[model samples]
Target: MEQGEFALSDREFNRVKARVYKEAGIALSEAKRTLVVSRLGKLIRTLRLNSFDDYLDHLERQGTPADAQDFINALTTNLTRFWREDHHFTHLETYVGQLMQRRPRGENGRPKLRIWSAGCSTGQEPYTIALHLLAAFPELKRWDFRILATDIDTNVVAKAASGTYPETELSGLSPQQMALFERAGGGQVRIPAAARELIAFKPLNLMNNPWPMRGPFDAVFCRNVAIYFDKPTQGELFARLGALIVPDGFLYIGHSENLGAGGGNFKLVGKTIYQARAQQKARDAA
Candidate 1:
């Protein structure tokens, strides 16, 4: 095939769509045909495959785990930046402040806080959470605070774990915020050790049932992730997230996304911010 001449037949496109949806829960519509071809074309060339059918056959017949991972990485979208949704961070600060004030110290004589940044692409969301919280509340330094940043794409998870980025990625950060990063030579900057220390990056697939973490997290940032799934998948995901969050704990989603009917377990408290209500309802029923 000539350069820039990748062609995906209708059958091939549908096959690709089905595989992606089944494996990743990403609903790729007919409109995404171009995207499928464009993203996968590079990968095909890299692997020296002649056509989509050949690649698909190889994937099903003899592909290794790494090959499957590369396919997912190629199709997965990881567009994100530091403080992309600034208001969510502001709400986070307020919520944490109130939580710190109300919650008593643990038996260990220190308070514990956990925030899960689900679908945290390339680290920004969780790092932003760590930086903002650490700066806004110095007391958190002495407390047991952790941010769990997980994404479906292993490649992005690795990048996020590095906690380093090109300097251009710092465009929106304030001077004070910028100060929290160290100059990584070659036009890159790294998240300061303070913020980096608070986060744990892991590769996770939301479609997988029975997520590993046993959480009653203080908050969850699952922003911009559910939009990729179909309605039923989205509903199931939000419901599962509700189960893991403590009553009154906050959930922040992407501005473009909404919980719709799936949000029955949560109450809308701010722009795309929800407070979990299931535990409270159970207590009331009791």
Candidate 2:
């Protein structure tokens, strides 16, 4: 186990994959061997372990909750940019307009709007949603509106909560958006408190049952997250998501992912967007 070269054998890779799947429900493929090796290499060096095997053993024996958290954080990929898929924002605007029209005003004379950004790595997606909500419906600023941004990785969740980023991270934003939503200084930019206040970032594991929040959200953005899950896992996860959204509520997935043949609870409305069929019917009946 030299500084430059760390060996992760097939046996080690398979073991790690099984552990990841059990803990996080993310199915790592054989192709991810290089990624696993590269990600864990630093942990090995930092612990001064002799090899990947030693690191694994250390994890097994002395692995507290914090150690487990670190392992998952290392293996999970958190690649994202602001408004990564622009079309979703357009659809969100339309959906928000319709929702506001239908939204009940009797709840203390202010309607509630809830959006969930599942697997919100580093917070960009939720922040993007917040900015869009403010831009599309400035009236919402006076109403009760909130976004829940969750990730299994505690590290990313903390970063997301910070609402601060280096200038390089602002590349995905347009000049107008950049001017409107962020305050730039000291070679860095931070989202204004108004936008940051709209989101709550927390750690969540999709595989865990009895989720804490009471949902029926207006929209859910779970993009690029289920790509790592196997088919059965994807089906179950989407079904749960469908349950959490209001009827006619929107579910926005990644450009490359889809709700396959078994997504019976929802109907395709736009590119990579699914509307809950039951929720829509319920809304109509009410």
Candidate 3:
């Protein structure tokens, strides 16, 4: 395993990434060749493989399940930032505040709310959501709620579950956010108790056979996940997501995507954001 050589050619890279999209609906666009090269090609060289074709063949013949995971991991777009989409977190902060203030009391006096950060790369999105929640409800220390965070990349997911981030990822945070979710050491930041407790990361593949998890989520964050899928697949995936989101729950997509061709089960609430269909609200109301 060398350190700087890449066995995968552009054509081979596209072929493998194409299979990823075909298998999982995660589009690996042309613009990301450099990313693949930078992220996975290093791994190819490290594996001491001289050709991408040989790498594939070795993976097919001698690669373990974990090795297969590494293969897929190399193909994913893990280019995430803290507060990557500021609006979603702002929207979450606003909505959750409203939800808490408007929360109906059960016999026991508690605010019950649930949020999911689907396709939560590494862990930034869910942790960001947690920061917002904690900031908005300083008393959330007393509440029983959690953020369900999941992604298909085992390595990143594992890293996220550990709640550690490199220094660069913390650059986008406000000083307040920095204090709340980080330790100020040289060149590193560690996630704090608040953000760490609020999110639970697991391995998830959006396009896998029969989704890996089920949800009746009050809010589900599926941002930037459907950009690669074709119309039919997108539609089906959203329809499936619709089934999981609480009738009155919220659905958030990437700023660039539209659920228009997918389905109208959600009505626009914000730019690229939608609330579950009215019928769902009606049922919840009843």
For each of the candidates, the C-alpha root-mean-square deviation to the true structure, in angstroms, is 1.8, 2.5, 3.5
User: Per-model C-alpha lDDT, please?
Assistant: 0.89, 0.87, 0.77
Ranking by TM-score: 1, 2, 3
Off by over 4 Å in 1: 1-4, 278-286
lDDT of 1 at 131: 90
**Model 2 weakest 10-residue run by lDDT:** 277-286
Model 3 C-alpha lDDT per residue in residues 125-194, reported as the tens digit of each score: 8888887778778877676677899888888888889877778787757887777766657777887787
Candidates 2 and 3, the one with greater TM-score: 2
> Which scores greater on lDDT, model 1 or model 3?
1
The TM-score of predicted model 3 comes to 0.84
Candidate with more favorable, higher TM-score: 1 or 3 = 1
- Which portions of model 2 show Cα errors greater than 4 Å? 279-286
Reference-based TM-score of each model:
0.95, 0.93, 0.84
TM-score of 2: 0.93
Instruction: State the displacement of the C-alpha of residue 218, model 1, in Å, after optimal TM-score superposition.
Output: 0.8
